[model samples]
Target: MAVYTYTVDNANLAVQDLSTGESLTDIFTYTITDSDGDTATTTLTITIDGVNDGAQQGAMKSKSWSQA
Candidate 1:
């Protein structure tokens, strides 16, 4: 297993390569406090999907394709 951390601007969010072997979901919380004793909070969700990345080595037994 591995862990990755990222820093982003306040209006930008992005994630990639999250469908590898170790698919998992995580929640991150951020809090900001202003000088006038005001505060704001934000929540972000990180989700990783499980997908087979390896290719078939043998002859093609069957195949199918689709688009949505």
Candidate 2:
């Protein structure tokens, strides 16, 4: 019997500064090691979709203009 361990190069794969209607793609490397010191590596792709935040948008204000 052989024991195998799996690990990801990037533990924190969170997206930052993403805005609405924007998308981001990130690639990460992962490896699997066996008790015999044999290892296999591959890439993992992650896609993050942006969302709209209503609170971030301010309320619309109305203004009136008069002619002098």
lDDT of each: 0.60, 0.65
Q: In candidate 1, residue 37 scores what lDDT?
A: 90
Q: At residue 35, give the lDDT of candidate 2.
A: 84
Off by over 4 Å in 2: 1-21, 57-68
Predicted candidate 2 versus true structure: per-residue lDDT over 19-68, tens digit per residue: 68787777878788888999999987777776664554455677999999
Per-residue error (Å), model 1, residue 41: 1.3
Residue lDDT tens for model 1, 19-41: 45655566889777878999889
Q: What's model 2's lDDT at 62?
A: 75
The best candidate in terms of lDDT: 2
TM-score of each: 0.39, 0.46
Candidate RMSDs in order:
12.8, 8.8
Q: In candidate 1, what residue range of length 10 has the lowest lDDT sum?
A: 8-17
Model 1 misplaced regions, further than 4 Å? 1-23, 35-37, 55-68
TM-score of model number 1: 0.39
Model 2 worst lDDT window (10 residues): 7-16
